[model samples]
Target: MINAGIIGASGYTGGELMRLLLNHSEVNIVAATSRKLAGEAVTDTHRHLKGFLDLGFQNLTPEEIKSACDVVFVAVPHGTAMDIVPELLDDDVKVIDLSADYRLKTAAFEEAYAMEHRDPRDAVYGLVELHPEVAEQNFIANPGCYPTGATLAAAPLAKAGVISSVIFDSKSGITGAGINPSPVSHYPNMAENVQAYKLTTHRHVAEFVQELNRLDNSLTNISFTPHVVPSIRGILTTAHVFTKEKMDVDGVRKLYEDMYRDKPFVRVLDGSPSLGGVRGSNFCDIGFEVDERNNRIVVVSAIDNLVKGASGQAIQNMNMMCGFDETKGLWSAAAAP
Candidate 1:
């Protein structure tokens, strides 16, 4: 069995990691760390994982975790992974960081995020469908939740040269902000409301542009807008693109279906998929409508912010890194409301 460890194991992503790893047959969860709940039973803190992990949360040093596990998942904040990933690499432990630190290859984007690129040489972007090779080779840089949904929604058309330019409008549940309490997450304020918080300056903009740009260098123009809805989980991405040539709805659908024919996680839907349909699974459900009237295409994609967006994708990377089935631990279906 491959030994696994989770650093910064108290947040939503960490908790989801624990839940998925519990059912993962090939993984032996060696350590789960949390400064606040160190030495406490992991279940005591995350009631959902109470009986799954009998071990207590340990406040472990990088050396300690390196010695105990074959791989370490750095699920900390954007600026923090740079510090922990380097030390883990020193011990030869494959690192899968779920942060913005290593996602973008361009140094300028790193500066825009306000975090210095410490180990710029080691990390790889971990969008499993697009960068399966990265998962096979070295340290993985898991894509942000919004980026995952948005990129998958548009990549097929971009590759086929079906669309000239893409505009992505994504809405995510409040949990996408993290477990921290903020004025934006105030219960009264968030309830019965839908607000667009990060209009133009959201950092994921760099990631969306960088990934699509990599696919087709000529595809330059991309517009992205993200909003925070009152719900607790899931992300829905709606992309609008103008086709280079007039394409029928069935033709566009066939293009997407053929693109994802071999991919297990991305599902193309006939009708609009609800957030709850993909809430607890790694699937990115996509559906589209071709506006023959305006010669445009509108596509919608949905994923659980914490699952496909974070922990589940992290596990998918682990499966690829360790030569296990990509859907091994992620075979469970989405939660139904």
Candidate 2:
């Protein structure tokens, strides 16, 4: 079994990684690291994983972690990961960064986050459905939560080279902000509100543009705006795709189906996608409809931000990098009501 280690094991994504890796047939989680929470039971921070994981959060250094683990998941925040990632990447280990550090081209990352990229190296962008090349790499940069859903919603159209312009309006749950509670997460501020922060300047736009541009570079018109709703998990993206020519409903459906037919985690459905159906699962449920009158197609996608958007996708990369079946531990149903 592959021994896995997760750095920054106190956050939402880290906890989610542990939760999913528990069932991995070829994995044994050996170390969970958190400098501040060292020696404490991992359950102290992740009460939901009370019985399944008994490992304590260790304060292991990069060398120690690399020695003990075959795969290392960097689950720290964006800026912080750049500092830790370089030390972890070497001959013996595979590192999957669940951060924005290596997801973009170094220049784009520096421009978006307004920080110098300490380690500017080539790492496969771990959007497995589109980039099947992760199976050949030692390091992967997991896609951002918003980009995962938003990009998946419009990817078929983009890849078909029929997209004239795409505008994405995404609503994500409170947990996307992370484990720390902030003003927006306050009960009174968030309970009945739909707060749209960073209307045009949200940093994740870089990732959305990066992935779509990769599919169709000449397709320049891409825009995104993000909102935070009262829910705790999942991201629902509604994409308004204006095409060069009118696409019929059957044709549009065929595009999505043909693109994702062999992809295990992307479900192309007849109707619109909803968060409830994909919560706590690695699936990205997508649906689209053509509007003949406007020469446009409306596409929607849903995914658990913690799952397909973060930790679960990280493990999916791990499976591919390790040459295991892609769905070794992740082929399961969502926790729907």
Could you tell me the lDDT of residue 232 within candidate 1? Answer: 93
Clashes of 2: 0
Q: Cα lDDT of all candidates, in order?
A: 0.87, 0.92
lDDT of 2 by residue, 218-328 (tens): 888888889999999999999999999978988988888899999999999989989999999999999888889999898999999999999999999999999999998
Query: TM-score, each model?
Result: 0.96, 0.99
Off by over 4 Å in 1: 90-92
Q: What lDDT is reached at residue 21 by model 2?
A: 94
Scored by lDDT, model 1 comes in at 0.87
Best by lDDT: 2
lDDT of 2 at 177: 88
